[model samples]
Structures are given as C-alpha cells and as structure tokens.
Target: MTPPAVVEIDHRDPALQAAFCDYVPRVFRTVDFRRWCEWGEWNDDYRAFAVLDEGRVVANASVMRMRLRIEGREVIGYQLGAVGCVPSHRGRGLSRGVMSAALESCGEAPVLLFANKNVLGFYPRFGFKPWEQALFGAAFHAVPGGEPAPVLDLVEAHVREGLVSLSEEGLAVTERFGSRGHARIASWYAANAFSRPLRQLHADAWVFAGVENGTLYIDDIFAREPFDPRPHIPRLIDQPITAVHFGFTPERWWPWAGVAGEDSEAYLFVRNLGPPSGPHRFPVMART
Candidate 1:
C-alpha cells in the first residue's frame, strides 16, 4: 500500500553501485556504468537518486556536477542523466519523485540534458526548456602526403592512461561552451560507444573521431598543450571526400569560421542557464 522511498545511491558502497548499474542498462541500452566504474573514473561528482525495490534499483534519476565554460566564463552547473523507471514501475509517478529529489539537491544550479525523441515532452513539466544546438562544419581535403592517424585501443591500460592524463592536464578545447571536468564521462563513451576510435594526432593530442559515409566527425579532442588540429585532420582519414564537422565549438582548433546549421539530433534541454546568443555545441563526450 505504501510507495517505495527514494534514496541517494552511495557510490562508496559497491553493492549499491552495482545495483544502480544493473538498473541503468535496462533503460539506456548503450551505456555501461559498471565498466566506467571498474576503470575507477566514477567519482562523487555524479549523484543518483533512486527508488529501491528489495535491494534492486527500480527507478532513478541522477545529477552530475559540471565545471562548464559558457560564453568565456567558468561556472559550476549540473547535468541530469540516467533517468528512468522500469516497466513494472511505470505510471506510479516514481520518476517524478526521483527527479524532484535530484533537482532539489541541485538547488539553483543550471542543469542540462540530452533527451531522446520519445521523451521530448516529459522534461518541460520540470521547467526545462528546449535549447537549440548548432553544428559547425567545413570542407575537407586530405593532404597528399598524409598518413593515417594511429588508432589507440581503449582496452589497453596505457591508452586509457594517456586519455586520463590529457583530460587532467590539457587546456580547454573551447571557451565558447563545453565541459571542463569531463574525463569520467569521456571514458564512459570510450568504453561503450562502439566503432568510435581514439586517434593520436600528436604525442599529447588525441581525438575521439569516426568516419561515416565520407564524412569525418571529430567528437572531441584531448591535448596537453595549445595546438592547431587542422593540419592533422587529413591524417585522421585516408579517404576523406566530403566535409568535416566538429561536435564542439571549433574556434580554438580551426582557423576559418565554420558554417553553422541547426543540429536536429541534439535534443538539449536546459534549466537556469540561458542559451548562448550565438551558435554553439556542447562537447559530445561531456554528456552524461
């Protein structure tokens, strides 16, 4: 007769963390929080509010503390993710309970999330407004003498270590809009997102890129120093024939002003943070 109580998942407790992990893939088929946790990148920044049904997570919502750069200013915000209620738990307002608890924990901090087409109308009930995202792109031509960038296997310890180092020491890839402390989320994508590879440009520079249908999508770059990645773009793909697009703001990496167009796939919703006046794309790797 009584509803299950929502509780905060304690990442410090392995059992609770495992329970949370088991519940996640049931909702998000592509995400693997367990693998990310095994890599030891899961930290206190990510907090989950959940409803437990006999030691198993049945409904959940989470908030990730983010160090974000918006309009050239550094500010702390929150990201909402891992939100769902199991099929058996649906229609009982369990999701609403957990979401309210998660937002309450965030107080007045800005929160953002990427929702799928199915849930397009669910978030607005919580005061989240849909924000438009732009894709920045330019023409591409492979350099005549370019060699393919070496792809690193993320399964290798050293390769993962290299990304960890760059994530900690590298300069901000963009000042327009992106995440700062995003190493953990980046690692999550590295592990679970199939086919996307980590390519080495310089000894200290690595990029999460993929080639599809003659187009190269540079999702995000990790570099230990300030450097132009344009020259190395040709090396990223051996047979590029179409355009190159950046998943984040490209002002710091490219010389030319790229053309901007609406990103239909970017279903971004925000609370407490006004959208930037100009075009911008949040780093693909930073989304939780």
Candidate 2:
C-alpha cells in the first residue's frame, strides 16, 4: 500500500486539541500531551501538524514559539518538535509530509530549531537553513543542606502556593533573550514541554521518577536568558548541596575548572525567526 495520505492538523486550535487528545496516544504520547492541552498549555505562536493515513495518524510535527508584538509588528520565533513517523510507516513519505507541512507553515516568520548536526542537514531541503547551534548540555550543583532536593515538593509547593518566583525568573530570562533575537526559547512552549514544569515535573522529578535516574538534579530547563552559566555557581554551590552533573551544553554551563565565572558560553541554535536588526552570529551545525 502507498500508505495513508498526509494531513496537517491545526492542533493548536481548541477544538482540535480536545478532539485529538485521546487518539494522540495511539500514535504519539511520549509526554502527557493531552493533559497539557487540557490545562491551557498553548500559545497562538505554537503550531501543531500531522500526517494521517487511513484516518489514523502516522506522522506528527510541532513548532512552538512566542509572539513578539514589537512596535505593532509581530515577530515569530519557533522551536520545532513532536516530530516522528510511525515505525511501520518509516522510510515512506510520512516524514517528508509532516516535516514539509511544519516548515511551510512557518511561513516567513523565521523558524529555528535545535537538532543534531546530521538532522540539521535534512532541514535545509525545506529552506530551514542553519544559522546557529541550538542543542546544548547542562550542568547542575546541589545545595549542601539543600542537597539538590527533588523538585517534587518544590514544584508542588509552588503550584500549591503559586510559587511563581522561578517562573518569574525564567520569564525575565525569556524576555531578555527574546529582545536579543533569541525568541525561540523564551517565546514559546510545546505542549510536552509546557505541562511538565507546569505540573512541577522538572528534570529532577523526571530523574527521580526513573524516567532518567539519580538525584534528578535537572533535565532540560529551557531559559530565555542566553546568559553565561558560570555566575550561577555561587547559587549552584551554595550550602546544603549534595551533587552536580553536566550534559547537553557542556562548554557553556559545565564547571570546567570547578570554579565559576561570569564569562562562559552555552550551546544554542539561533535563527532570524522574525525581521533581523542586522547581521547575526550563530554556530554551524557541522560543529554541533
């Protein structure tokens, strides 16, 4: 069989989000996608699409971003994800279908994504030219007495008590990066990424859940700051600490000298998802 034809879904739309909640599991359910949508986890800047065959989803793609209304003009920055084609349908046209749909929908809004160098090669065929590195590893330091405590209670308490301090800090960083043209990180959240933190399901929680392992110090904490990770050492090294680890963006956030400094780099991928102020600098996927 040629397989089912491709269909791009407007998953962001409320009706669609509700309609597809149950069916998403039959195809893709790595994260609690249905619950995320049910909890108001979406932005207009976010777009979700899929490829269907025989009326069932065989492929999917999602691009989540934030909208910046600068001087009355909307700037779109997107992070691509929720991408995969059913195994049985692999090597067919499903990947092409969903991928093409996602990129084309990006329009002239300047799409960006963090993917392995090998994967980056596949994007250009759709006009997703690489301008920088978006993927990176992260490091963490636990509080001594604090003992790199699990985010479970912390996340729960915050939600229970409206502990928006972290979110606020994260937002500040998001705003800073958004202003600097790194809008993809700050500007949006994909459903899978959104509800985790919203539910206080942090990297540490995931780690503790055996989803990963160890202290669950942290996993992927997307931020908008685009700042050096070194300065946070004092914060990372503060008293009540237990352990620290690094992954993703090693060069930038890792403790190379076991010391902290204000000057360091993090791994990231940047693209002009919107109008550019002028020339920009980004890493080539070849190096990532």
Best by TM-score: 1
Q: Which candidate has the top score in lDDT? A: 1
Model 1, residue 256: C-alpha shift (Å): 2.4
Residue 84 of model 2, lDDT score: 66
lDDT of 2 by residue, 195-287 (tens): 222222233212111112322232233332344543333332324333443322233334242322221343234455443342222321111
Candidate 1, backbone clash total: 0
List all candidate RMSDs to the true structure: 2.0, 8.8
Give the residue spans of candidate 2 off by over 4 A. Answer: 1-6, 11-32, 67-74, 116-120, 131-171, 174-288
Among all windows of 10 consecutive residues in model 2, the one with the lowest summed lDDT is 279-288
lDDT per residue, candidate 1, 1-288, as tens digits? Answer: 465588998668899999999999888876778777887767888889999989999999999999888978888999999999988889998988999999999999899999878988999999999988888988876642477889997767777778878886786678888877586788788677643788998798888887777888888888978786667777887565477888888888874747568889989999999877678889888987
lDDT for each candidate structure: 0.83, 0.42
* Model 1 weakest lDDT span, ten residues long: 139-148
